[model samples]
Target: MSAALIVLILLAVLAIVVVSMTVKIVPQARSGIVERFGKYRTTLSAGLNIVVPFIDKVRYVIDLREQVVSFPPQPVITEDNLVVSIDTVIYFQVTDPVAATYEIANYIQAIEQLTMTTLRNITGGMTLEHALTSRDQINSGLRGELDSATGKWGIRVNRVELKGIDPPPSIIDAMEQQMRAERNKRAAILTAEGERQSAILTAEGDKQSAILTAEGQRQAQILTAQADRQAQILRSQGEAQAIQTVFQAIHDGNPDQKLLSYQYLQMLPKIAEGDNATTWIIPAELTKALGTLGGTIGSIPVDGGGSKTRVDYDASIEDDVAADTAATNEAVQEALDAAKAAENPATTAADLPSQEEPPPPPPAGGTPQA
Candidate 1:
């Protein structure tokens, strides 16, 4: 019974060991590399995989999914000899577990070192300013180089990216200042252009206003001159017609010298009605024509009844004016005559001064001679 128990224990221990060596659960997205006696043998896919218990040895368990690796910042000297710190991230996947196990001892470390070297080489050709501004170009270049170099190792560099690039504090400040200065320069230029446009607009407005004013004045003057010319032409035509009508009437009626003389005398009062008239002249022909007017008036008919009688227009006007005022002026004249008779001796009508008497002496304080 003791020997049988010992044999059962031995079988159980062997079974556990064999099961441990033969069965493998690779999990999802994982692969296992198996070797026979320290030599390349086979690879195990995800899920239950079987191998020889003793001869086949699972050497490496490789993750087949994409992975991320972030490296610390590295100082690189640029073309201008300026040192800058740069950090990077790499995304990669293992397609073949066999080659990934044998080709490189540490693929992650190898990738990291290769990335640092490649970064230095690429950045070394560019100035700090160019490196700072050209991140996408640098990322693409690193990705291309890493993908090519890592291909043989059964590694696929899916993508490479720059995490951060930091320059000196002084350089950052200088860049900020330069950006600020450029913005201010643009603002000033725009302001000047706006002012120039405003001035031009103002000048154009004034020029247009002046031109419109002058044009309006010219049009008004033209209209006024045309109106004045038309009025003068009408007046001249009217005067010419009037003169022709008057000449015809005189020929038909056969007017004597008396009518002409009387019409001429009547025009004298109208000529004196001028506002600016200070002096006027009377023609010498008026005196001789008055006698003809008197003789001709005696022969003219006094009324439509064909009664011929001599009529004095001046004497008739004087008689009518005296008759209207005689009653009202009689009291005033009697008072004046009585007052004068008291102040001086009573004199007859013959004692009054006639046109033949000599003129009295000039009053004192009269106007001086020019």
Candidate 2:
């Protein structure tokens, strides 16, 4: 009985070991590589997988999902002999688990090395500025080279990226200064252009304003000249009418010497009242005109006078009487001349006698005997 129990217990222990070794459970997004006697046999997928117990072994369990890897900065020399530090990131996936297990010993290390070499080659052909600015080109070259080289290793390089590129501190400062100077130059140019445009606009505005002002003044002057011309014409017409009326009235009245003498005496004071009467010239006919006016009043016939005998007033000096007579005769002659001149329709103020002239020498027969 003891020997049977021992054999059954041993069989059960062996069965558990075989089951544990044959059945493999792989997590999601993972693949297992089965090796038969140290040689690659087949690949195991996720979930339950069967393998030869104690003969086949799951050597590698590669993650089939995409993976990201970031590399540390590495110094590289550019075409211009400038050294710069660059870091990169790569995204990869395991497409074939069998090839990935059989091909490269360490596919991750190989991919990293290939990426570094490819990055150096791409940057080496460009200047520092070009290398710094052309990240997309560098990434493309890295991805192409890495994908092609790693394809045989069952690794697909899906994407490659340049994480950072750092130049020397001195070079960085110089580039910053250059950029600042460029911005300042652009600002100055824009300011100068603005000032030039403003000046042009201001000058144009002033020119237009001056032209408009000149136009307005010209119109005003034209209107003023027209108004003055009209005024002058009207004034001339009024003066002509007034002169004609006065001349006609004078002829119809036909007054005697006494009436003419009285009118002359009244006009003397008015003439003296002018603003320019500083040196008034008393005409020589003034005394004779006064004497004629006094004689007419004195010769008025009264009820007691015999036929109103005309009395001649005598001056205190004989020389005065002679001068008065001469002035009176000259006045009477001027009156005759004025009457004849007045008959002409072309008579003007200039045709009138200078001083006071007696009324048409009482028509030769109408003269009173003094």
Candidate 3:
């Protein structure tokens, strides 16, 4: 081949090689860090781009999207000198690809070691209980420290979380017991409160019942008193009606002294029959009643429809005296028999006063001449 033809062929091959080496296509959410002579030159964004063939080279490819990094468990000492194992997860994203490539070597490994050391340091200042309970505080603290430190490395730490914290077996057992005890205590307190409420409700119910019963009794008493008052009013009205009827009957009859004496004598027996009767006093007008009765008997006609013959008043008085004496004797005998039955058997007739006196001897002519 001619020398010119060989030169043209070599030029064509070189051009093709250069073009192939210079062309670069970055993927979505990614960036390429370019370097010249082992020094960072520029960063390439997503899309097609070109670089000086031999001078510029892609040194690092970085992902700009958020990522998760989980670290293995690391042993840490707490404030109480207890060793615990802790694992963590971190969320981060690369903001600047050039800085991420040049600022730090092995950024993921560096961050993991730093996180382990920082976690140990923080946990060293806290007891096991605080370390277990303060996960959010520790995570926030670790995230702040990581974010500040990784700013130059083009890494932004979004969040940090403690995946787990494992304590010693003895501590785990002790915590379980403590939890059980707390649950039991809460249960006991609840039971006691329930019983107290039940007792209070029962007492309240009993009190209400008692109050209602008392009110019912009071109402019943009031009703009984009203009934008694009404009954007494009716009884008084009935007695008044009876007395008015008796008075009207007597007025209608226009009874004489004889009728009056007869009615009084009839009432004496009824009065004596009552259990409350102790003694009865004879009226001072009893002798006048007898004389009136004798006068009425003398005025009474002997023959039916015959003009009244002149009656001897003194004879009638004598006859009345004898009749009264006989009636008194009989009444006294009856009263004596009743008194003997009511009294002790030792009582005799001699204890009583004489009811009859012997009438004055009749006049010698036997005409009841006075």
Candidate 4:
């Protein structure tokens, strides 16, 4: 009975061990490679999988999901012989578990090494500037080459990216300086353009202002000239009216010697008021004119005078006015001539007569006044 109990316990323990080895549980998105006698047999999928406990062994467990690997910065020489450090990130996936297990010993290491070589080759053909700016082109080239080569190892390169490209410190500083210079150049050009436009606008404004000012001045001159011309015309018209009125009064009223002498005396102050008058010339008929004025001064007919006396006085006054008109005109003309001669030294004294000839022979039976 003891031997049977011991045998049963041993058998049960062996069964548990067998069950633990045979039933394999793989997590999601994971694949297990089965090798029988150190040879690849088949790949195991996720969840419960059955295998011969002693004969079958799990050689490798590969994730079927896409994986990302970031590599350290590698120094690469560009076409211009500049050493640049570049870091890369690679995305890969295991498509065939069998090939991945049997083909490459370590797919991750192999992918990383291949990525380094491919990146060097791509960057080697370009300058540092080209390499820095052409990250996308370099990534595409790297991905294509890696996908094609790693496809045989049951690894598909989904993507390749350049995480960072660090140039030499000196080269970075130079590039920064160049960028600053370019910005400064653009700023200077913009500033110059602005100044030029401002100058043009200012000049145009000044030109407009000058033109307007000149036009205003010209118009003012024209208005001034028109006013002067109008004033001159009015003055001439007034002089003509004055002369016409004087001629009419003389013809109708027949002024006497007293009136003629008084008119001559009134004109004396006006003749002396000229701006150019330097010397005064007395007319030769001054004494005769004054004598005629004195004689007629008290003889003016009064209202109480007799009608015969009044008629006789009126007749005498008419005779005297008609007879002295020529002498008065001559005297006035001499005064004007003297004023004109004083203004211009070119006038000869013979061109002016101081007095007229003695009045015509008295009418028949009329006395010739002294």
Q: Residue pairs in steric clash, candidate 3? A: none
Listing every candidate in turn, what is its Cα RMSD in Å to the true structure after a full C-alpha superposition?
A: 19.5, 15.2, 16.8, 13.7
lDDT of each: 0.75, 0.74, 0.75, 0.75
- In candidate 2, stretches whose alpha carbon ends up further than 4 angstroms from where it belongs are 1-11, 219-263, 273-370
lDDT score of residue 306 within candidate 4 = 14
TM-score of 1: 0.64
Alpha-carbon lDDT of model 1:
0.75
TM-scores of all candidate predictions against the true structure: 0.64, 0.67, 0.67, 0.64
Which is the better candidate, 2 or 3, if ranked by lDDT?
3
lDDT of 3 by residue, 1-370 (tens): 9999999999999999999889999999999989899988888999999999999999878999999999999999999999999999999999987778878888899899889988888889999999999998999989999999899998999999999999999999999999999999999999999999999999999999999999999999999998897665555444434443443344344445467567667888998988888887776988786776544432321112111112222342232434544544544453344344535545443443222432344455453211
User: In candidate 4, what are the lDDT values of residues 292-328, reduced to their tens digit?
Assistant: 6544432321112111101121222223433445434
Clashing pairs in 2: none
lDDT of 2 at 191: 100
